[model samples]
Target: MSNLATKKLSGLLLKQLGPHHLSSTSAFHTSISNATAENSKPMITGLFRTFILELRNHSTLSSDELMKPVQTSSHSAQGKSEDQKDQKAISSYWGIAPKKLTKEDGSAWRWNCFMPWDCYKADISIDVKKHHKPSNFMDKFAYWTVQTLKYPTYLFFQRRHVSHVLLLETVAAVPGMVGGMLLHCKSLRRFEHSGGWIKALLEEAENERMHLLTFIEVARPKLYERALIFAVQGMFFNAYFLTYIASPKLAHRIVGYLEEEAVNGYTEFLKDLENGTIENIPAPAIAIDYWCLSPDSTLRDVVTVVRADEAHHRDLNHYASDIQCQGLELKEAPAPLGYH
Candidate 1:
């Protein structure tokens, strides 16, 4: 008895499953105007639907539930409300929203480098060429550190600015990673967040390392200079670690001054390139790839981007110092995670 009834129902379904039957649904509509008209029409015809349901073998489910699969494509716009409810449930089941953007709204990732690309390209506006007098003991110490490093660079690597940059970047990359690591440990120990400082500092470290990598391709430093880089990096890393542990504010101020000097150095380098004192050769392939530069990028273009990055770093360090000066922690304010 059950087999006979199942065969009858199967034959009925087959009869209704023709191409013409599909035409009765809206999915294969050929014209936009007709599709729109079909979409606007009401789906429910109570009398007709009831009459069709009475012919079915089992009438346990409603008409809407029975037709759900076929209507899915046509009802996409209408399904948004249903999706919202499901999305809310899913978001609660997970910790965060699935579709949330990782970075700020405007910025996105660069393809080759996998670094954040600033959509609103901010220009370097700070006049780093101007010198500031030391106001307090901390300021004086910061000033002294920057001045102490300047003369050796000038006397030893004269006209070898690319090599100078390679050295600077090697040292510059250390502070951010150290700071980020320390902050990460502190946060974990205290069960507190560092706002966004850990990510921001790590990103800065990565950016500075990229600068080092780019310049290495262009500069090709001698054996002695590479040895000098090793010496300077080892000494500086230990000194900075201790200094940061003693007073983070003073350490940040020192970095700010260091970045200011970097900006000045790059400015002079740019001037030489412009005045034909130094040849503006094609940019390093790594620089072109990392910065998303044009195929015809030059040394000047690479310098321009590096200068802008230094200016941004200068501003960030100064801001961190200011936050510390006010007797507030860096966690009190949000860090600019994707400023680069």
Candidate 2:
């Protein structure tokens, strides 16, 4: 064929094939080159070179048209791009779209910190006064450690219940995350099931985080308090991580004692609310939804449920420590899933 005729043919072929077949054309060119190289046939090699020259010329001329389809695809992707832009500081190409959620009443679920299925009514009937007396050296050591931490915190926050509980929840959420993570690694290393303890501990962590979120709606922490939390969380997370690695028994025991202190703290908060020392304001909307409380529930009711939650946590940690004291791995016992 003449040079002009060959160029025309390649252009026509590209037009007929459309943009999607451009990659196939490149593949065909590659295969032809490989075949020509192997066969060392002069006629075939000449034809292949001519074809490559025509394709290159045609590609330059039709570049705009080829890019049209790509532009159309990019336009289609604009919606996803816009969605990602709307999300602050979170850009991902993983296509992990968020699901729209609604409450039973058909209202849009507002909280991303938790989902509807995570919400549950507190077992207010759980014995808040239940105390695990430290019988052994380990138990006593844990109790005193918590006590040593507790008195200083009480003196610092004084009767400022909101600030006190805010800090409490910050520290409270740590052990579960550390325990869950260590257990997860252990499960992977040992190539055995975690007896649901990983999920249980993670559940506790998320629950405690929800508590912090709920309280945040009620009271914005002071700058100093926020600084305190920053310092405390950094110190506590590393400390607890090391402690859990060294001795899970002692770690769990300490958490149990800490929960006991939390229960006491919230109890004191309730008493203040009851005596009108602190106003019994309407419960934060997050708290009401999280605890599945009545629409008209008050701060008093929120504190009641939160205290009950602490009690359950206290029991769970004490139970964990007790199991360890019996000289068995946590995996030996079935985890109390959804204990709170």
Candidate 3:
């Protein structure tokens, strides 16, 4: 074919495929079909053979060059470098990259909700039966307040242990959060430290939330029960916030009594489990991990650890109230971090 004729044919083919498809190998076939419709059979045959030769020449280099492994390795390395750059960019954009964690057995950590450092063996030896006797008017009022709240809850749930504890945990989780948030703001406003009280209270809140998560695995709540939680949590959070603002002593005292009630309730739960009134099922995985229980641990073990935790919370809150009652700021005494 003449050089001018070849250039004309190439232009026609490029125009048929459009600029986007010009570089695509598949476009050649479509171009050939279009050309056949426009030209005589003899001219079309010649153009097809010319295009095939051009494609073959462009597709391959010298035999020695095609056999080289270095090219393949270099291309793969370049691709890997680009992928690493993309990953780094994404990580930088987010400003947080998850750390890879392992268990003591060197197995991959399975939970994103909590880290291994958060796991601990519950101090089951803690005295669960310990009670704070109401020594004054405020103490008496706090005790009666908890008692008043406790009875109606008992009447409502009766022996529904899972549902009862689930609701209990939801309420239990709130006070710490409210106390922590208030203390955090107070510390910031005063330009003073919280004597670690903020961290301690937040930790307590997290621990109580973990209890809720553990129970949820055992028994999902019904719609009505969840609705009740919504109403109760909203009321309790606001009421406790105001109480904490008015008097941290009375607020802590109320939480101390509430913890005492929680311990008592768990004791009852254990009794039922022991007597076969409630099935002593294997512990939920979340409970086992959180409490650092044995793989074969049962629900009885879970309740036992939870009861111990309540006992510790009771002591800590009562101690806080005691410090405040003596006209000392909570910051004067170091918080019992990791009390449980």
Candidate 4:
């Protein structure tokens, strides 16, 4: 018989309705509209002015262990401090690189990429200027990935299965999300942006690794289902990211939206940890959080730092909009989830 554990994840996802998410999204839409309103570019300096005050209450209170994040790093070379080393572990989960933009209203006319590469797949080592050169392997890889991951969000939405199914689903899904994030991180690397994003993704990747490992460690270890999830996530994200490189606008916004959502989920997870209401880490509800939010609780500081990366996503969205808006007039209406 199908246990309640499988259905449990679905129910938990439906329960969150908080102001941080609503306001942040709303603010995003409003800012986008303001930028393009009147065919005018507003000075972007003050856009993030109230960032700390605005989101402070929304942030989860930190634990004594996770207070610094520096104390959380794994062993590394160059003798970097723990925080710096820890920063190197979670690369893809941070959403610190370029983002994907989607219409909150669920409009299909989404922004694809900011720089417009077309994912032609030439030599992967080529500079951004040569991205359009089109290699057969890259194009083929992107296509396969999209086809495989066609149902990520949908599959994630499904409820009622088994404990092994849940573990398999989560293990499979996390890596795809991690890889998608890595592609974005690499985008920043290509653009010569700061190493901060790279560092963040590394940490996130580590987090994904932990979750995957944890699922594997479970008594059942549903290897077959887990494999399916991995393949789907891997394929979908690679293709999605290739498209993102090609268009780089709304695609990035989608990324930003997802990351922000992840942050919200992680922050909530920490809150649960604080309350005795969330007793065991392996509780079915907690497992859902593991699958959907972040899987890295080994270092509580990871939640704060990873969430900070989500906060920084707003800046990237603003930057991408500015870059992509070459004389295009932005309408003054807000879109769903804060797209204008």
- Score each candidate by Cα lDDT: 0.75, 0.86, 0.86, 0.39
Pick the winner on lDDT between candidates 3 and 4: 3
Which candidate tops TM-score?
2
lDDT score at residue 111, model 2, on the 0-100 scale: 86
Q: Sort the predicted structures by lDDT, highest score first.
A: 3, 2, 1, 4
Give one digit per residue, the lDDT tens place, for model 4 in 22-133. 3434553365344533333231333343344344534664333223234333444344664575674446664665444333344332322111221111121212111111
User: Which residue pairs show backbone clashes in model 1?
Assistant: none
In angstroms, how far off is 181's CA in candidate 3? 0.7
Candidate 4 residue runs with Cα over 4 Å from true position: 1-225, 280-302, 313-318, 326-340
lDDT of 2 by residue, 252-311 (tens): 999999999999999999999999999999999999999999999999999999899889
RMSD of 3: 10.0
Task: For each candidate, give its TM-score against the true structure.
Answer: 0.64, 0.77, 0.75, 0.31
Model 3 over residues 109-228: C-alpha lDDT tens digits? Answer: 888789999999989898888999998999999999999999989999999989999999999999999999999999999999999999999999998999899999899999999999
Which of the two, 1 or 4, has more lDDT?
1
How large an RMSD does model 2 have? Answer: 7.8
Ranking by TM-score: 2, 3, 1, 4
In Å, residue 303's CA in model 4 sits off its true spot by 3.2
Higher-lDDT candidate among 2 and 4?
Answer: 2
